[model samples]
Target chain A: MEQQIVKVKNKRGVRVIPGFGLSMGITLAMLGTLVLIPLASIFISASQLSWEAFLDVVTSRQVVSGYVVSLSCAFFAALVNAVFGLMLAWVLVRYEFPGKRLMDGIIELPFALPTAVAGISLTYLYSDRGWIGALFAQAGIQIAYTRAGITIAMVFVGIPFVVRAVQPVLEKLDRQYEEAAEMLGAGRICTFFRVILPELFPALLAGFGLAFARGIGEYGSVVFIAGNIPNKTQIAPLLIMTKLEQYKYADATAIALVLLVISFLLMLFINSVQLYMQRFGRG
Target chain B: MAQKRQRTYQQDIVGDGILAVQKVREPHTEASGKGIRCGLIGICALFLFVMLVLPLAVVVINALRDGWAAYQEAVMDEYTVRALQLTLFTAVTAVAVNTVFGVFAAFLLSKFYFRGRQILAALIDIPFSISPVIAGLVFILTFGNVGWMGDFLKAHGIRIVFAVPGVVLATVFVTFPFVFRELFPVLNAQGKDEEEAAALMGAGWFTIFRKITFPHMKWALLYGVILCAARALGEFGAVSVISGHLRGKTNTLPLHVEILYNEFNTTAAFAVSSILVILAVLILIARTIVEWKKA
Candidate 1:
């Protein structure tokens, strides 16, 4: 019916697919109901408070610490995933070894594994009496119930994003430029630094941004491991839950507002970056 | 383009060089010669094993320590059994509902044309960026006491914030995107040519969908459904907030594990966690296979 009604366009057309008008309308409605309305309500509820009260709630010592821990851990974890996840992607794309399939499979373990279960497992494995924790404990290196534990959990959850994002780029990459560099007598390291890294830069940033976003809101995994030591190891998500549990509704909303705002801005920036990359990426 | 070309070139050289090295490296000192590739593979496996496998193995070992007796005891307990049943029931319902709604949304996004398309596309990712816990909070603020719709619903006694209904709602929120994300790309790549051809041959929408479209979407749909199921079963933060964690009422398996762990019943926690681990492993295996086939 569509083909019969609509004339065929030239190959170099404005759109990739037809029916853009209808699809976009339906997409708008779905997004409105599922996302926009609820998010709008969060901000509205947040606006109910006076500016001073909002400031007080967001600036409390515990709240400030929570923000610090959550943000710093998210940043560092994403950085770590960016660095190592690229390596993992490179290995998968460049090498053929036994258990290659297994490595690929395990890369996504964090996605299917329940955050709570992962947290419990991490706590069990890294607690003072647990296996690795015993070694860390003896060396005066804390893991579980500490900032380090939070970072570990964040990294675990965030690694998959980087790997998934970078893998396809590595696979689709053409081989001419690096060969030319090598043919020009460039060292292996120099060839990599000069010829390859720039192309991956956009993808790397996008992946890092995604990982950072994911790490911020992480709860189930971080909660158990962080020990929720208020003002110390407590992340913002936990702080929000704690506030709610304690019947501090106003404070809870305020803290949640802070997280929501930060996450919203962060995501907006990332989305723009991704859009920029997607545009430049094709060239 | 330069980067892509360079990356591939480097990779080919390195990969081929390593293979060549493996063949030519003498027997003596061969281990050191194969160090880079071998060490890289070994390190990746070790990281996966320590992080992904060990805790899961510990749970399984602990659960089976007393053999079938312990497994049976845990599974047969009234609270444990009830929680398990409710979790399964809710997960199934959530995934099914999300699948229908998700396919519609994906179909619309993939097939239609309209205004606000870019904005709408961005909104699908809201659930992804927002915490599940925060999603629950959003629902509560919209439907709970003092919520925007609370007064009208409370008058009708149609509670939605503190029962199984709320759990299902939260689960739906988290899992809604799974099917849509999976199906959108498939739909984009396949296009509507064949469906239009079927329509030209006098097929109805349902016929075209059932015979022409679903076949293409089947594997992706299955993949999405499985991922959604895994998430629904293991959902803790969102469901816990809205469900009130009412032991037999809202306590999911993950919550049950937490309760047991807090009670210091490590065995029970491990036992329940082991079940989830098995489910996760199955999902992981299925996802891996599907992805490999796609690749």
Candidate 2:
């Protein structure tokens, strides 16, 4: 019995802490029931549709337009976030100012606040009678119930991803690089563009990808602001809801399957990039 | 010696000239640097104000736009009250279940080297990337009338889709990764040497965890719980899909806000939203405290 136990240990390597079976059992059981099985149902339901029918559902004009609005709005929003998020992170990390901690704390507000609240509040704020919206109304640019409104909603939800992603990397950044660049006659703009930005690129890209992916998948915040105009401001997730509401289960599954596949690929890419970055150190 | 002395004298004068030039430029550069700093800070402040702070303020202002009496009436409405109760129940249940699963998964992944560990970690993160609407959709497809187990569930007299169980299930799915993600890094950093040492001394796994691992994980676990609970409390899209708009029966706070807003009961919607905003603030405060403690 002792020899058999030793052999088992030798083969699998030593695991001194007990409860492997118990922990693995509970983890897999919960993960399977709660996450995997339900996710698989999407695939199973989608598979029930023939390839041609699946293509037809996903490629239909309204659905195609939904994809366009979602992807474009998310793209622009993430782009905005990448720029502003870097600025916020830079301000938080490099400068000492009043209310810095408060600023830091509220960077997570979007994450903590309910999307429904954000949706209603944003819609109100940017509506024509509201303060900011009234200003834009005079400028002859409508925001609420438009593509711009949808983009703003996306930006709000995606803000935390980039800020949180880049903050740590920025904080850990070596100051010596800045000093060296300055000593080498690099001006402030040149130093930032050439020296600091390169180092922050990987983290910035990771944040951008996360924010973009999130913006694409965002629903509650955008739906109210999006105005749900078919073939115009309608987002992909909202279309799924529309299909579900109409009891078109197969159609909903097909759209969801497309989204799932895209998001999965994006996540896989981000994870691999992160893994590579960790191995190679900061770029 | 005289030639070297002459060269030293020239070098000293040249150095003095350079110093004088830099001294002349110092004030100007310093002023610009300060200006740049203030500009950057101002932009960040303005953006965050517009994006985050302003929307929060709007909720409060609009909620009170109808006067205190009206705000109170909306909040005290029977359906709103029921929705609040249901929201609390779902948040608590989801947090409790995820907390247990988080601990087990964290321990298993951090302590033991096993096959398919990477795949498991990735699988855990799937919920985070997937849309909440899809999360709800998957559940409906699994438990709705035409689902795979639909007939079996009907035979058993079980109703999950468009019911409270479906609501809870969707909440659980979306918040699944939060606790595990939070706990894993802390556990992995602490490593297994201490746990292994305790084990070799004839301590049981539970005892070792209580005396050793649990101490290190307490703050992270709390942080995770706060995040999970906050998310579970505010979840809208998933609950919205699964709840079937059965006001007073299935509406969570977020869904209640939606129903109110859509019905043009704008004041009522903002009032209920104020509750969630306050809860979010409280969670933010709790998260700040946990971060400080963890650090």
Candidate 3:
């Protein structure tokens, strides 16, 4: 038994502290109860419906519009977040100024604040009679209660993901590459594009994926700002919520299964891209 | 020196064109560098102000729009107080269970190698991407009257959906990954040295953990718990589905805000929001302190 223990240790590296069984038991039990089985319930329940029923729920006009609004707004917001968040990460990592610490701390407010609070604040700020909305109204622009408003809410919540994701990568990056390129007579912009951006692209992509995924599932943050008009600004998550409220449990799960499948695929795609980029960078 | 020669060569190259006269006249590019830096910083500052600071200011401003008497009235009202209690109850329940399970999962993944570990990690992150509305549906499908286990739970006289227990379960499902994600990297980075050392000294597993790993993980555990609490407290989407919107009963703070807002009671909605805003600010302050201390 002692010899077997030693061999096991050799194979998997040393881990002398005992009770792996105990920890694993606790972990698997809780995870199965809380996450695995519950998620599996969606598939199980969804399967109870016939093919026609499933198709009917998923292909409904309202559901289709919800998918479009959610994806487009999330896509646009993530794109916006990618640009501004990259810049924000760059400034946070590369510069030192007064209140920089305060600014760094402020980026995470959206993560901590209630989505309802964020929603109301955005709506209040951009409503027709509100502060920023009044300015836009004069310029013949409508923001609140439209796709623009939904996208803005998404951008607010999504900013932290990109900023947080890219900030560490930026910090750990070696400045010598850019300096080398510069010494070879490349201008700042050229060196940035040729040397720095290639290294930052993977982190940027991962950030965009995260922001986009979160925006897809986002409800409370978008619902208030969206004006919640069906086939207009409504999102898939809100549609599910509305379905469940009306006790259309089958329809709710049907829509959920679709969203769940898409989100999983997106995550898998992002993970693969990140893995590929890591290998690409190493070479 | 090579540096001096290179500088003059650059000057010569610049002197070969219109840029040359400006470089020689300025004699130092420090001012231009400073100017560029200032411009970038200015833009970042303005962007953060417009995006983050202004929205935050709006919450507080509108929450207190009607002055102290009305603000106090809204806060002291029965529904608001009930919502606060329910929110706290659900969040505390979630944090407690998630912390224990999170630590266990973290320890298992980091301390031992096993098959399906990657699968387990990915499963934990399911919550991170799953929409909260969907999060609620899965639970309802498991526990609601028309649910798969509905007959079983009813036979056992246990109510989950549309009750406080349902709210707790949904919160747990949504915030499940927060503590685990926070602790997993920290524990992995810590390695198993201290635990192994204690084991060699004839210490038991629990003793080794209590003496060594817990001390090392204390701050991270606290940070995780804080984040979990903030998320649970602020959760609107998941809680709304299971809450059933019973006034002074199932409604949490966020749901209460929605109820009031839908009723067109903007003043009360904003009033209740200020309290949640304070909670958010407190969480942010705690988070900042932790990060600052880490530095």
Candidate 4:
């Protein structure tokens, strides 16, 4: 048994594929140049600022407001997407309706559409004189150039993430559990909440995280509608741009580093939760 | 006593008959089910129409608000044409570079086992989470006037930041993961058994790839390429940062739209946007076809 184990280990070291060296070289080289080195530049530049100065730059009144606006709007947008996207995914999977295929196809429109174009078009649609905005205007509610407009733009870009994430999992879900719940005298709503929802929680969470992350980092679409109001509608990404435009590279890098760290932490949290859920589901 | 027992037995029979009738009516509950289904579908349709369809329609309507002559002039304007050329060039170059890298990276992750393999896989996804503005900013920090390579590049008379190369680099960075993300799953699912067998039979690496693996992944590769191209074409924030808004030089189509819109040239901006709208629609149609074929 010991000899066999040793032999297997030795054999494993000699990969049968001939291009391993070539593939690894290209992967590392390109990843270094395009991703790693460039990302490291943010840190390197940011390190120039002392901790106090970094704190001062990131925590100033305007910067803090940018974070507030970005976080709150992203949170609202992600929440809205979680509910609406689930509906769309459920409808697409369960129903045989007219234009179902068309609906399914266009879910990715946000992904394909340019952010700038979406920005302009959404800005136009929600502006006071625009078709949809005109109705809201009658109620004395302004959407364009406000937080409401920013949230809507975030929703537009984030719509696809949730729907796409939940779709395949929803499709693969076994109907036996649902039927069993029904047989046990559970109502439709009860079965959905107790059985179906538990099964969908992981996908839903993943979708929510992705949408939230996208919303936080989103720029082009939100910028046009945000009206660039300094203390109010300014998003964190736009703040970074504003700093870069002013040639304040150190300040820009400091803010970007903070945003990047937040994103990384969020990703790590989501990934670990997913890993845990998979293990629990298996057990 | 016998008459009372008979009456009780008759009542039991009547109760059972009524229960049977109810059981037979169970399937008719679909009437209410149909209503709920219609309502859900309606909500979805209305949501999509208000959120997505209307915005897209507005682009076309506003673009033509100034009539065909003006629309034609905006699209055919010298600067607009120049921006279009720059957009196409950046997209093509970025897609070409990333496609090559993607093939290599996907092969490395899926085909081989190594230490830190998972880390490598996760690292490729960094771009997705990073903001586009950061993406451009990173390049500036690396190659800008005050950057690490600034002295070297300047000494060599090489310009990257605020030039065409910077635009391409930023686009490439943002789009780096798309092709790899798409291709990895397909290749990983294909497994290495066939390649292993081919190698044992002394087939060359290129031969094994061409005859065995390439056929399986061609559709996925094309799908990835289309996605990459679509993204590369429309990238704004990243390109905007590094391009320095050099009119007729570094301005891509999306930046051009911003410039036109900012200048109160609403007609021209919408007209330019209409071109991207058309491109986006074409991409959508192409994506749908690829998805159908893949499935």
TM-scores for all predictions: 0.88, 0.93, 0.93, 0.93
lDDT of 1 by residue, A62-161 (tens): 9999999999999999998898888888889988887788888888888888888888888888999888899999999989999998998898889889
- Order the numbered candidates by DockQ, best leading: 3, 2, 4, 1
State the lDDT at A238 in candidate 2.
94
lDDT for A121 in candidate 2 is 96
Candidate 4 Cα errors over 4 Å, as ranges: A1-14, A281-283, B1-29
> How does chain A of candidate 2 score by TM-score against the true chain A?
0.92
Query: Model 4 over residues A178-274: C-alpha lDDT tens digits?
Result: 7666554444555576789878888988999999999989998999999999999999999999998899988898888888898889889988888
Recovered fraction of real interface contacts per model: 0.43, 0.77, 0.73, 0.66
Ranking by lDDT: 2, 4, 3, 1
Ten contiguous residues minimizing lDDT sum, candidate 3 chain B: B20-29
Interface RMSD of 4: 5.0
On DockQ, the stronger of 2 and 3 is 3
User: For residue A59, what is the lDDT in candidate 4?
Assistant: 93
Of candidates 4 and 1, the better by TM-score: 4
lDDT of 4: 0.89
Q: What lDDT does the true structure give each of the candidates?
A: 0.79, 0.90, 0.88, 0.89
Task: Indicate the residue-level lDDT of A114 in model 1.
Answer: 84
lDDT of 2 by residue, A1-283 (tens): 5436755769865777888999999999999999999888888888789999999999999999998998999999999999999999999998999999999999999989999999999999999988788999999988999999999999999999999989999999998887766554555665676789878878998898889998989999999988888799999999999999999999999999999888888878877887786778644
Instruction: TM-score chain B for all models.
Output: 0.83, 0.90, 0.88, 0.90
Q: lDDT (0-100) at residue A259 of candidate 1? A: 87
